[model samples]
Target: MVKWSISILLIMLLNLAVTSLGNVPNFDYHAFYFIHQWLPSYCNQKGTKCCYPPTGRPAADFTIYGLWPYNDGGNSLQNCPGSSYDVAPLKAIQNMLQKDWPSLTCPQIGRKFWLHEWNKHGTCSKSVLDELAYFHAASNMKNKLNIFEALSKARIIPNNQFYQVENIKAAITQATGYRPFIFCNHDAEGNSQIWQVIFCVDKSGTKLVNCSGSPQGQCAYSTVKFPSY
Candidate 1:
């Protein structure tokens, strides 16, 4: 009778363990969020001193923050199962990365940044399974969007001037056909400043689309500053 009781207890524990495992969040993703970060705001927000790239200063325009994978409802997924980052796949666009996606902090650490991005975010993407595909899709989208030109056409220069959030959104929507989620942080003076612009793309990574889940982050003021690099 004691043996039977012990067996039943083990079985119950095993079932509970399996049930808990099943309740853990899934890693599979349904969409992508192409996040672009402005260099100055990023460096300024960190509080720690930022190291400049040996090559030169990163371009003042939007550089990639990351390409994140999200569920249909826009919940983000990270470090999915069976995901590994290999820079070998990215040789095809290494030059483009240097030009457009150069790490603003210690350019030599670009590899580390890419690796972290892959393990943390890119791995969750189904559409972009490997490093090459992941980066290619992100770079291609940046080229296609030409966000700087869109803002330029609207005369929204990043000269530390404040611009209306609506106008900024309108300019981007007119350029990409989909509205983007703008994220910002406060400067030393507590002035709200632009930090990142994120866009949702389809699973195929072919077209820009509206985010199914509402975008996160809200500006404290109607107008926000865009600090120059």
Candidate 2:
């Protein structure tokens, strides 16, 4: 009887392991790796001294603000410094939403925005917002809106030219099937104003990434990887 019980326990453990592994998506790590390679070099060459967080942007970083003026506060948007709010991340988020819910509507999408923006403020940082918008739009939703509806109702774009939340979401989802995680990172130095996608899971099972760059060069990119299980 004891031998039979032990065998049964082992089988259960094996099944559990299999189930966990199944949940892991077949991710295209190469695309992300290539992006990383470009970031550092770009920062070294093109990062301007006058840009927001005033010190200097990094050459290569995963966050949108590092690449463009999405969240960098200096621009006209004025939500936060270094907070330009890129359309790409928002598109990614939108795509994810569509994947989660195929029949989503404008109102439903609005509810999500309100929840993420207000209720779950901390969890959905700038990066996450981008990802959410991107995924939500890309996954589904066939109808396209004019400039006014897209900007006012959806809150996707800042101006007519730039791809706001709706447009960003659609673009990202079309590019990548999966949406990236978003979070903030701050180290010992006081710099603290950066954003990026959470590439890996942290030790506590949370997705992790680094987003830090202050007015002084003191705060810069740090090696932030997901924690081990």
Candidate 3:
């Protein structure tokens, strides 16, 4: 009789543990960042040298970086199970991608950087999107938030001019109706330059959402440089 009670108690305890764990939230990814980099700023950073894509020099613009998944704790999710990156599915928008998402590294190659982004970050976003859908969403996002145009409208040309970080954020916010987080890099002379503009995105990866956490890097300087291409 005592043994039976002990066994039942143990079973009950095990069941309770399982139930508690099951109720725990899936904090793996509830939001994401639609991140893009300023090509001129990137090329101007200290100890950096950039090469144009085979098609030719891309225009002076903020280029597509990645659609990164983020957990509630602000950790980026990566390497989840999903299809590997393939160019076949992206043929329809190949030209657009080449223009917006081109690799600026030495010995630039077509689709290589994209393939890396897909396998590393895009795969982890499979619960909300597929390979083709992911790339398409990124393209749509780029079209929607024309950062260059937004800044240009504010007369913030990338001609080695310095601007307050708050003003930069204000321009993007005024244009998109969603606030952006800016990251900075240092120029050859160690002056801070804006590198990436990141926007928060919801789980659907469709619409804009407010970001939760603070941005990394030093964008808090009194003035940040906007380098020319």
Give a tens-digit lDDT track for model 2, residues 77-166. Answer: 112222333344445354333323222222334334333332222122333334343233322221221222322344432221222222
Best by lDDT: 3
Residues 1-229, model 3: lDDT tens digits: 9999999999999999999999964636878888989887777766777887778988878989889998877777777775888888899989989987877876545688898899889988888788888888888898889999999999998889999889999999999999898888888889898888999888888899988875455376777899888
Given candidate 2, what's the lDDT at residue 171? 37
**lDDT of every predicted structure (CA atoms):** 0.80, 0.29, 0.85
Candidates' RMSD to native = 2.4, 19.9, 3.5
In terms of TM-score, the best-performing candidate is 1
Q: Give the TM-score comparing model 1 with the true structure, all chains together.
A: 0.88
Candidate 1 lDDT over 38-147, as tens digits, reads 87886776463567666666666788778888887778888776658787877777778766676766443577788888888887774456768788888888888888
lDDT for model 2 comes to: 0.29
Instruction: List where candidate 2 sits over 4 angstroms from the true fold.
Output: 25-27, 30-229
**Over 4 Å off, model 3:** 1-27
Weakest 10 consecutive residues, lDDT, candidate 1?
46-55
Candidate 2: give its CA RMSD in angstroms. 19.9
Question: In candidate 3, how many Å is residue 171 off?
Answer: 1.1
User: Model 3 — which ten-residue stretch has the worst lDDT?
Assistant: 213-222
